[model samples]
Target: MTATLTGVDVAPPAAPAKRRRPVPGWLAVVPLLVFTAIAFGVPALAMLNGAFTVKDQATGASSYTTGNLTASLQGAYLTALTGSVKLSAVSAALGTLLGLPLAQAVVTSRSRAVREAVLTASGVLANFGGVPLAFAFVATLGNAGVLTVHLHLTDHGWDLYSFWGLVIVYLYFLIPLMVLTIAPALEGLRTQWREAAQNNGATGVQYWRHVALPVLAPSLLGGLVLLFGSAFAAYATAAAMVGSAVPLVTLQIADALSGNVLVGQENVALALSLDMVLVAGLVMAVYLPLQRRSARWLA
Candidate 1:
């Protein structure tokens, strides 16, 4: 009884689990917000002002006016805008069509060597750009190029400087982009699904149309939009290949920046601003529908 009276040893109550101070969410976002304000918001506002404001050359006076904006909508500016949309669409479609098969081939192959080779080749071609790629294309297809010289194909009248020629050049960039984008989706597809589809007597086309495409549609569409944007924004390849002979929107913008002969500098600024607005609208239009569809599909 006297021994039981000794002080009993006991562990101290565990310090209330140290409450992690909630990370200030705003801190994480401040950098992005600052970047947006500086990089996009201010510049966009300035462009809007420049698009409307008339700057007098002699008096150095600037006044807000809609005349520049209106002027940008007419004549060659309008034509170039339309051409850009058409070109982007055509190139995107072509890239997606070509990429689907290549993606399937790469993802389905059992051989790691083949996959590595294909991916390495794709990466190399994708990075190969600007003047070197242009010159390579020229050396292969130009009137005085190897193909023309060796095969005597000049009689067929193949020209790589035309609108279609730009499209062809664009594909070199587009195909690899599509492959890089779509390959991930293909790899994500479960092997059992294909086997199940085969066991159920579904033809390969039916399997793709019904089983695979629906699953892959979101990725495909996203990649297509990316390809479209790439082609739309591309400058050097088109410039080097076609130059001023073709009136691309990028070329027009470049001319504006350089004070080229065709469009006045102010008008050029207005034209570029107009193009930015249009492209922003287009991106939103495409992105919204795609996002909604992807959400629904994923849900």
Candidate 2:
């Protein structure tokens, strides 16, 4: 070491920095891309192909036509579609309304255990569908079911097989799903915004109307549409609970797929799928933009 300017000596220069490994970029996404192509893309293409055609089984000839779609939209099929839409809409609306408060509760709760428990339960409940869920509801409320037996509910003319009972069953999962979707949106709301509103002497309702509602509107709408789609595509639970009694679109599709109906039912089933896809795509088109706008505030 050498002294400099009759003072202390400094150390030698430091070694060069090591470069970090470059991220895997698109490779990281390849697995999901492959899975999507297999699961969603394949089925979508198959449905599109099947929807707009008729195949002559004996002659091995295929012809394109819109007749399948036409048949799908007319008569009892159309009624089923309408019923599904109405059910989905009612459930989505109810879920969104009820879930907002639950989400806000979860978000605002001071206890870590409360938040974790709610979220954990929400995740499980959202996915708890199909035969088991339907069977459970039936056992709890169906004719001569547990509650029905204990309370003599049938004397009151309450029918669990009816549309209203189905709606109640749907709410179980729908509300939890809505809670999960809306929770993040609620958390995205800055505390500063609430404080700012309070600083201006705004009441709770006033704050919600002028500030929080506008910010949350997109998220809520997105969640609503998603809920609608969830209810629309649901098959097993509806099938198991009410069976042929409920003329929902999914049940009709299942009937057609099972070859239990007239000729050309296969294409008709696919045509129904196409209709559902169009509705889902339309909702997604609306949802994406809203989600992006919501992200701006959150970001």
* Backbone clash count for every predicted candidate, in the order shown: 0, 0
Candidate 2, residues 1-299: lDDT per residue as tens digits? 76789799977788999999998798999999999999999998999999998888889799999999999999989999998999999999999999999999999999999999999999999999999999998999999699999999899988888787888889999999999999999999998998999999998999999999999999999999899989988989889999877779999998898877665589999999898889889989988998998888777
* Tens-place lDDT digits, model 1, residues 37-121: 9998997777777787876888978878788767666777767767877888999999999999998999889999999898888
Stretches of candidate 2 above 4 Å error? 1-32, 56-60
Q: On a 0 to 1 TM-score scale, where does candidate 1 land against the true structure?
A: 0.84
Which candidate leads in TM-score? Answer: 2
What TM-score goes with each of the models? Answer: 0.84, 0.87
What local lDDT does model 2 show for residue 248? 95
Number of the top lDDT candidate: 2
